[model samples]
Target chain A: MSTSADTVSMGGGNNSPSIRAKVQAFGGFLTNMVLPNIGAFIAWGLLTALFIPSGWMPNEEFAKIVGPAINFLLPLLLAITGGRMVGGQRGAVMGAIGAIGLIVGADIPMFLGAMVIGPLGGLIIKKFDGLLENRIPAGFEMIVNNFSLGILGFLLMLVSFEFIGPVIEAANNGITVAIEALVATGLLPLLSLINEPAKVLFLNNVIDQGIYYPLGMQAAAEQGKSIYFTVASNPGPGLGLLLAFTFFGGKTSKRTAPGAMIIHFLGGIHELYFPYVLMKPLTIVGMIGGGMTGIAVFELFDAGLVAGPSPGSIFAYLGLTPKGSFIGIIAGVLAAAGVTFLITSLILKMDKNTEETEEENLNESIEKSKAMKQEGKEVSAASEQHTTQIEKISFACDAGAGSSAMGATAFRKKLHKKGIEGIEVKHYRIEDVPEDANIVVVHKDLLDRAKIAHSDKEIITIENFLDDPNLHGLLERLENVSK
Target chain B: MLGEHLKGNVRFLESVNSWEEAIRESAAPLLENGSITSKYVDDMIQNVNTNGPYIVVVPEFAMPHAKNENSVEKTGISFLQLQEPVMFPDDKEVKVLFALAAEDSTGHLDLISDLSGVLMEDEARDELKQAKSEKEIIDLINSVE
Candidate 1:
């Protein structure tokens, strides 16, 4: 069951995660919630691709799956899952209830609204649950919880119908008008500036599911195909970046980008490229350049697709293309890749760290470690000397995934090698950390947050989580307490 | 692994007033074994106080752990089956508590992986819930893989 996310306050301190982090987290959360049901989306895409009269093997009877899949099941599932992530079973119920408003209020499929409304409803129910926690008397808990959700859900449903329903309809209309105007004026390529960045930030599903899918469905129902489906869902820009990174980027990118390229361009999981781009902010300009070129090429060729490719797979894009439009689609993809590669190669030249040979790099790290250990012994012997046992050591980060989790694992391995016993080392999201944590290890970027969260506790900042030299100091302090 | 703790540390508690009490009861065996320090126990209970009960990880089950690296004297896992379920603030009720203490993050991973395997199988979890003695619980764990 999903609970409300601990609200992270922004604009508080320089060390707190940026506004970009919050948006990225929200996008990450949405991506995670929707990812499990990718198969269902594929099923709908397949059905639409095969049976839509102009399809490969048109079958009207089998095509019946399209309506239910698009109109009800997809959005219904998204709401339940998104809401469940926010609240729990109660939240899921209310989120599903609230989502029905967007579904019935408009002629278009309301998957985007479901993504928002369900989570919002669940969050509201969770807030109510929090306020009433411990206040509900024993034996009367079940009834009160049930009645509260029922009343609150009903009120939310009304609010959704009366207020939210119309608002979404109007917003959808506004966007549609805007897109039509852009397309008419040959200014549609400008959308790549917004869509490409959002896509790399992992808002691909929201753009595809919320905006592209519904609009494409409407257009495809009237015409044979919709260019709107191909606009944001193109795999070209990401492929371009990966190709450039594979051949021209630093050693790390050169090694990893090929595998990522395979997963992204071929497998159609656009998310594989996000981390790569995130690691190098300057690389986004390459993606933006590629995205604009892709759109421009599509416009040049007048290319469109029968359906939105679920994973934005290159193969699926080709399959969905009209008989005569195959060259146009291929041209757009190649042009996007060529443009991205040219820009990326230039940007990567400024990346100086990856130039060192593996042996030299290893030697440098070893020398650095020796210097750090020498420094660590003195630091441990000084004012931070342990007088009492530390029961808890928490490795905290923004999302608590990459750095903190790996740091804890590496630190654990170090402790095991040292024969250290009975120390609980774990990774946690900064906000979810328990107050009982004796020592909090956080990234230097998150030091301010750690200080604010645990003012009384020891806050250790690690500049590089992967090879944190301060871990030795922490271990030395732990050993001193044990002695 | 969990086998050592399961053989001697597993217990069936008759009753508990609150979730905190249940956690304390669950960790008592670990504390007795010197697997965890007394301060670790307090910290574990305090984790719930601060973080709410995200510990009820699976249905009818709770895995209460603390970030108390210093409180850990050994790596161990203890089981406590409550006769009556204790409800957390989130309205989720839990009957089984797996209190884990690890001196380091990498230690006791095999035990956790095995326990998760047992928990995933409905029949195994049911067998665990019904087993009255530690030997039976040990047998159930052995039988899973």
Candidate 2:
């Protein structure tokens, strides 16, 4: 069982992440993309609140900023951030390039689409760059890197623009049909299933204003009250969601929820709460639950706004409330809020419980890494030497400056002299050695730092940057393995 | 570029009291020509203070450098050779110091490439300790570079 990673590839024994861990990692990536751009969304919501025709201080000209902002700016930012997360700066460029195609090609704002495309673009370029990595001649790296991205991005833009329309059209059609089928079931509360999800996707207007408001208006003409108006436009569910976040959300979400609440509940900007749902995704259950409760409450008391509440704010809700229907309307909103708050708090609490333990394990792992390092080193060193499949070797120094760079440069020269290929040798600060590096070469002097920072990897300690005996041993092992 | 940057920045010292004094004395040329500020000298010393003597790239050859952090006005390299070796931490003796003042990370890699080229071979590294003049040291670097 004790095998020295003498062949240079250190991670042959590492286990892959479990399903839950993989899902959480993906979820964390989603949260990272949405978290930074929430401020931009808030700004757009504030502008929509103040300037839209249904808004408090409606201004025709200033309101024009809303459409372009939502359609172009917010989506682009999300794509750029997502792309950068996967691909680095070039990925960001690729993300933006790919996103513009989606924006121009599709009729919708492309929020979710951009999220997908950005990372896809980043991944594309990252792979392309990886393929081109040492193959580019020394003097031509900059030109090759830029042109590869430029050409790939151009083709990606064409591909996205050419093919995205049918996909978006298909999704929009699917949502509309799902809404129609839910309405046909006559189980009014069931509408929340479609409504809540649609609302988060910026499809609020398509369902509420397009479908429900018309149906409610027709029903109102006959009976002076209908539950359709309250079905999707109830600000209760959004308010409850935000309130739950204020009390129970992650740190940044908690700090920002109060402002979002003000915009969602009072200002009637339902879009304000969309990012919160997008972040947790599971919180959509809370939204649907609150929504169904609100609709059931309205139908119980035969409550309806005589007209549609344009902005769907609490004020708008009351202003449109038929006089005798006040109690019913108020009760519906309150009930929805209470139900959503309870459900969302439970979800957030459950998330936090898992998160806290993950954090504890993370802290424990730091301490545990020392023991693991010793065990790993002994096993690797004592066992038969492994064969070479070394993909990445990181050289680390204190400031990422002197010794590490020298070591890395010299090691690269040795690798080239030995005609080794596909093994990435690079230097970093002691703490910045990437997770994917199979082996970290640190000077014997900084062994403690290397062990603490990168305990998961095989560590090779050398006394000299140029010609240490360990270096010679490693080189000979590589030569034998390569042969 | 590597030889040109070190043209007038080479000096000879008989000995230094400690590795700290060796680094300070080694980096003095960069300070005089305004290639780097005094803070960079302090950072390089602090790097050793916290990180041990990893900057001593070879057995008796030390390379002192730090994150520029706006402390370097331009990229330059300097050299110092001592007749009597100085005792670094852990009893490692260093006779030659290469003070590297890079304004940014990638700018002065050629200097490192040449330095590594010089030290990679045993005979050149041994001759480096014996090189008597600045021109001789520069030519030795050029010979391998």
lDDT of 1 at A102: 71
True C-alpha contacts between chains kept, each model in order: 0.00, 0.79
Q: List lDDT for all candidates, in order.
A: 0.71, 0.76
Worst 10 residues of 2 chain A by lDDT: A1-10
Residues A78-149, candidate 2, lDDT per residue (tens digit)?
889888877778989999999899889986667666777888998898778767776888899888988999
Instruction: List the candidate 2 regions with Cα displacement exceeding 4 Å.
Output: A1-21, A183-188, A191-291, A295-333, A337-424, A427-441, A446-483, B1-145
How do all models score by TM-score?
A: 0.50, 0.44
Model 1: residues with Cα > 4 Å off, grouped in runs: A1-16, A135-142, A195-229, A242-260, A269-285, A305-312, A315-326, A342-483, B1-145
Docking class of 1: incorrect
Per-model tally of clashing residue pairs: 15, 2
What's the i-RMS of each model? 10.8, 1.1
* Total backbone clashes of candidate 2, pairs 3 or more residues apart or in separate chains: 2
Residue A222 displacement (Å), model 2: 26
